[model samples]
Target: MRGTLVATGVVVVIALGYVLSCIIRPFRDCWVCDGKAHHRSKRNPKLSRPCRWCRSTGKRLRIGRRAWNRVRRVQRDA
Candidate 1:
């Protein structure tokens, strides 16, 4: 029982940290382009194209933030 309590507390702390981080920094660098906003061509390094994943913005909404937005929208609509 004691071990379970400690494990639960650790999980809660990690979850809270993730939530706070999502709130403080809602956007993260695009994984595909690594925030460069472009991808170099395989054949020619000089040629590059806009990142499709981030739509050239070099950032993406964190999953938690997206979920939060969805929840807010649903609540507002309801």
Candidate 2:
């Protein structure tokens, strides 16, 4: 009985991960700035500022997916 529950839990986790992987795009526009060059500040110090990660371009890439794509491209080229 305990073993069955463990197995079921594992399956459910795998299924959820699969669904998330499919739903979340590998690369997408930055949600925080909405593709804008700057992001609004949430604190009292400043009202807004340029994004550091996207360099204000508002484009963001998933690290894992980007690496996966590079690997596949290299393999295909080879």
Candidate 3:
């Protein structure tokens, strides 16, 4: 009974870790601007400006991704 309980606990922890990883790994870098946050202007071809999608941060996280991070934090704290 003791060994079974330990095994179950380990499995639950592993499953949670997997869930967190899956939920959080998809938003590391901006995909639209290719992490550069800017591209040569189409009209001028020589000037560049902040990417509209990522707002020039070069790192973009979706709303769901942000929420998942919060959930991960809460779970980790618990």
Candidate 4:
């Protein structure tokens, strides 16, 4: 019982931290461009193209923030 409690507490803390992070910093670097907003061509290093995933913004909304926004939208519509 004691071990289970400790494990649950750890999980809760981690979850809270992630929630807070999502609130404070809702956007993270794009995985494809790594915040550079563009990617170099494989054939020619000099040529580059804007990142499609982030729409050349160099950032993407966090999954947690996206979920929160979805929930809010549903609640508002309901």
Choose the strongest candidate by lDDT.
1
TM-score of 2: 0.42
* Candidate order by decreasing TM-score: 1, 4, 3, 2
Alpha carbon lDDT at 11, candidate 3: 100
- Cα lDDT listed for each candidate: 0.96, 0.76, 0.79, 0.96
Query: Listing every candidate in turn, what is its Cα RMSD in Å to the true structure after a full C-alpha superposition?
Result: 1.3, 4.7, 8.4, 1.3
Better of 3 and 4 by TM-score: 4
Q: Model 3, range 1-78, lDDT digits (tens) per residue?
A: 999999999999987776676575645568878888897788997899888888987777755667777999999999
Candidate 3 TM-score, C-alpha based: 0.44
3: Cα error in model 2, Å: 6.9
lDDT of 4 by residue, 1-78 (tens): 999999999999999999999999999999989999999899999999999999999999999999999999999999
Q: Weakest 10 consecutive residues, lDDT, candidate 4?
A: 23-32
lDDT tens digits, residue span 1-78, model 1: 999999999999999999998989999999999999999999999999999999999999999999999999999999
> What is the Cα-based lDDT of residue 17 in candidate 1?
95
How many clashes would you count in candidate 4? 0
Q: Each prediction's TM-score against the native?
A: 0.88, 0.42, 0.44, 0.88
